[model samples]
Target: MNSMTRIPLTQLDAREPKSSGPQQARLPSAADVPRARDTQFKDTHGRRFSYLRLSITDVCNFRCNYCLPDGYQCSDKTEPLTLEEIRQLAKTFAAHGTRKIRITGGEPVLRQDLPEIIATLKQTPGIETVALTTNGYKINQHIDNWKAAGLDQLNVSIDSLDPQVFQTITGHNRLHEILTGLDRALELGLSRVKVNAVLLKGHNGDQLNRFLDWVKTTPITLRFIELMETGQNPDYFAKNHLSGESIKQQLLANGWQQKIRSKDAGPAQEFDHPDYQGSIGLIMPYSNDFCSSCNRLRISALGKLHLCLFGEQGYDLRHLMKENKQTELESAIRHLLQDKKASHFLHDGNTGAIQHFAQIGG
Candidate 1:
């Protein structure tokens, strides 16, 4: 495959094995399944997984240009996993050496029982971190309850520092409200707080200095994620996708020191500055060796296990999430790990079944 060549979705689909029955058919026999070394989850590529991104819902209020620009449209009528199912899955992951669990959604706060969900994960054994990723639509109203539920970290999406630009990008003029909520979250002493922004070529691309200035005084990590090409919106992606390397180079030249990534950390490459109170992180998925340190697995709101965000397909795990299926669920998860690809084929323009970020809580 050449750098400029893109594999068509039809051709990609033809290359994958067609499944007529349930996804469970792909699972290996219990006797044939290889146990992870040290009882921790290790894939065929030697990557040890200890982090899980669990999406509780696919509903969102924002219409961000990069993700759900047309706003959230419910295509899958399947009910999201119940609270008990989420707890069971969290417990199973934790028992397998998973230390961190990030709760995500189209907007997790939309779930009225989110605080309870946080409390459930926090109470799970072997889990050390319970984080929430939200658009900050209701953080100001629910931060107190969320913090009291033992939420350890919070990541809010704030694409642009300028109010006008923010509204233009998200179709919402609540930046003031969201920023105020962040301040309240900080005041409550959350262990970690971060702001996420997608790097768009023309929209917020030139606002790097504005973002840097805000982070200079705020004690929060601001991450700029490179726009990725998905199944849908190839035209929009081509027009707006910007590389994170440019911003990284700027930070390095300005004396911002790159921090060593922790084993269980997310993909972002963090950078710190002596004079700034906060730091910067760059998530460049298209970069070389981006998936070498893969440590997390994604579970969609409907309980499908996605090995990679850009993988060809997801495996159905909801059927094995029954109360008495803990052992079976663990076995299924372990068996499925063997099928995880060494790396996603995003560089080849293969976005798998992901039409947008909201589908899998990107």
Candidate 2:
């Protein structure tokens, strides 16, 4: 809608690979690869996708130093996909083996229709889970309504437990309010509730014990995600990119055991400890073979399909999103899956075209 280049479905097979740098291994051409069956969404590498991350909006209010330190600025004038568009997209994906749908955004609560969106996903035939990732700005006021609307899982971004440090990181002092909302979600009988903290060096990198102590008593999974380098933050990444492998070693030494990943689980390597009431999860995108078990796909706030979070481009599926076009939409999606790469090139210092996490709901 903003005049961005929309890669048509017809050219999916004819388009050449984006790059052939040393970091990128020469993958087989699209013609040489076997296409996935129509019923299931499998890629050329034998990876089957069953989870969808749908970003409803790219507008956020946070001014975190690592992300939008300068705050959000609108680069495009296009409006995000409407509620009907999102509902149709979700139904299509659910029909094609997508069991879980996670609603994300710059802060998804910014959308007033979020409750209806959650309810629609829950009522869809093949969807088993409906999750939302938010910054918790207004969770206290909305959690009750969300739960009643059939929200199953919730992940809140709480970067630190220390109030002052939290304020410094998120540019807000609502830790108490957010934590209260998190507890309320548990009390409301939500199946799962998790906390996500992006590990930033010189900020919360040395504060693992603080997180561990809190999770020791709380019945929740606290996840530490390694700070990822985006197109907009190479300098910040260089200054504060902490590795999760160090945290993994520390957990192992402390007697935490790695758990087997379920078929539809996220990218985090989860661990459990007998002495703790909660669990720990580490999302180290830079680690070896990190993308081997990818089971999720991302759809932007616009209707483009992103095969990988760090891929070079997005394929436009909106053109085929009209009524009675489910057949064409499904075919376009399946054809695009054939070109998904074996892995991301993050290890090679390539962050692809992802200017920021908000763009694709990382």
Candidate 3:
């Protein structure tokens, strides 16, 4: 995310076009990405994976309703890795062909001296982009430091514009405060700011158009998220399951026409808006099932690497790191690749997120 290295524009949230003249060429979809027997990264057709989602910590400020419900028995906030540890890990992943790394957390800003962590990762060779996911409650307080620390773009989780709904969702009344933070992120020349809204059936689904209408004014991209089958959900996903098709119908009712195809990245399928300055993103991982082109690898707070998000298994990398056993780490990674499951059958079945989404990186 260092501006000196990459453009420092948001990698995960590319809502706005850089030019005012006309829109840039549309990005190719996952299906459009060329298929070959031997891709550039490795000999296998699969695992040409260049993206990695790194969870820096599991501590968050607010205990959101959908994430960890009331009286939810959660573990203590996870300990973040040292700067040296993160740099070494990034280097190893880069050597094994990972170009993009998105640093996530319950609230990564809670980690002491996040700028240093970001700077170290930015300095790592082969890491093309360094993005983050935050709640935006504390973002305004740390914007200058974050920008100075090599932080690139951001995806702020915002469920509702209504103050009461926001309070109810996040278990705190910071609705106006979070909106201020979003304004601050845009003011800091973030270039791209994607507001991720998790839609529940009866709760905030009614606010979809109202929220989208407001997002059209600013440069930030607004994305609708369908609640996944994670354990820590509101009423356990019973009260909140709004599919992607439902979201599309709402968008169509609002007169949002498709601009073109979305980039071959992220879970969201983005759409262009004729009336708005920025675009809308639809992340229907539950409905559309983008698992066929899913090439993501997740690392737990305890340093276990997971090949699939909803997969029940993960190989412990903490043991190897603690024992200074580098060979075992590579062996574990290879084993995961060899035994990777075809797709996560968790939509109508069991999602067994292994741990809560708050514990894992978003």
Candidate 4:
């Protein structure tokens, strides 16, 4: 994978942050800070990183069978970052060499003022592209505003296309709404739209090819993620789960020629289907273990930074934020980034062993 340059986008003319005092004057080397104790900002080959997925909230609107438990609740002791705080954090990362900013959430669209949030991040001096991931529940309603507010791209989570199957998997009966939102996001010029489909063993795993066929109708990139343990539905996955390698083999069997394509150092280990119009993606947090090149750090909705998806523990940046210790806050966040877990916990997508995606930001 080609290394993307890590540099802060200088804001020629931007509003002075509401936080008052300037964010710490960050050094370029500061970008190499670890999340807590396990991972690093650079890989073994000494590649400087630039992109980061910043979760704005952990409270998702949809309770997908694979993502959360039935009785899941947002941590009562802590809360999602305020608009100002998120902007500040983005600014801090930008100052430390963050270029691409992706705003994620339980479903970021659920945030009423998400447009404002995107706008806040765009104003940061070093932020290049600002994107959002959502279940598309509210995309049709606010997509225009989102684009108008400066959102660069979007990745919609769509598990199935079969109306009944979709409803059964997502708990909410809104396949048409999600599809409409995807179209609307593209129509409004959010060009880089991707559909994220979580592949399961018995659930919709078998229908992956059908989904791939449907995505070829548009330019939208289709990414098939192997369902792993990041939720309460352990029994479901335990009985019916497919690894990323298995998914790739199945695609190949269906006449999907797998010619590995070169691209950015992103999460999805991408490939091209020479025979198909659009490319297919495989994100094997299990089968293809990209943990060695895992440069992303997750910040929970309640404000804890996880060093790895399978992280055993995370430093409480929330407390530092709450107490308003400026220097400590910056130092603590940098320390967390420097301590990013080098390896993930396990390949098994189980609950007892690994933390849920909601808690870690998928």
Q: Give each model's whole-structure lDDT.
A: 0.85, 0.84, 0.66, 0.65
Candidate 4 lDDT tens digits, 1-362: 00111112131111111111233223323345434453323444344356667777667667777776462465454456787677666765676566788888767776788889889888888888898888878678888898998999898888888888887777889988878888888788775888888887777867865887786667787898877764355677777677778777777787676555334466676666655666778888764447655556556665555455665334345544433454455565554444444555455432322345655457
TM-score, structure 3 vs. true: 0.81
Per TM-score, the best of the predicted structures is: 1
- Score candidate 1 by lDDT: 0.85
- 128-216, model 2: which lDDT tens digit per residue? 99999999998989999999998999999999999999999989989999999998999998999999999999799989999999989
By TM-score, the candidates rank as: 1, 2, 3, 4
Write candidate 1's Cα lDDT for 1-362 as tens digits.
Answer: 00111222223231152233322244444566656468887788989889999999888999998888889877556678899999999989999989999999878999999989999999999999999999999789999999999999999999998899999899999999999999999999999999999999989989999998998999999999999998778999999999999999999999999999876666889999999999999999998879998899999888878788887456667767787888777887787777788888787877777778887788
| Number of clashes recorded per candidate | 0, 0, 0, 24
TM-score of each: 0.93, 0.91, 0.81, 0.80
**Candidate 3: residue pairs that collide:** none
Rate residue 179 of model 2 by lDDT. 93
Q: Judged by lDDT relative to the true structure, which candidate is superior, 1 or 3?
A: 1
Q: Tell me the tens digit of each residue's lDDT in model 3 across 224-256.
A: 887777644536577668787877876777777
**lDDT, ranked from best to worst:** 1, 2, 3, 4
CA lDDT of 289 in candidate 4?
Answer: 47
Q: Candidate 3 overall Cα lDDT vs. reference? A: 0.66
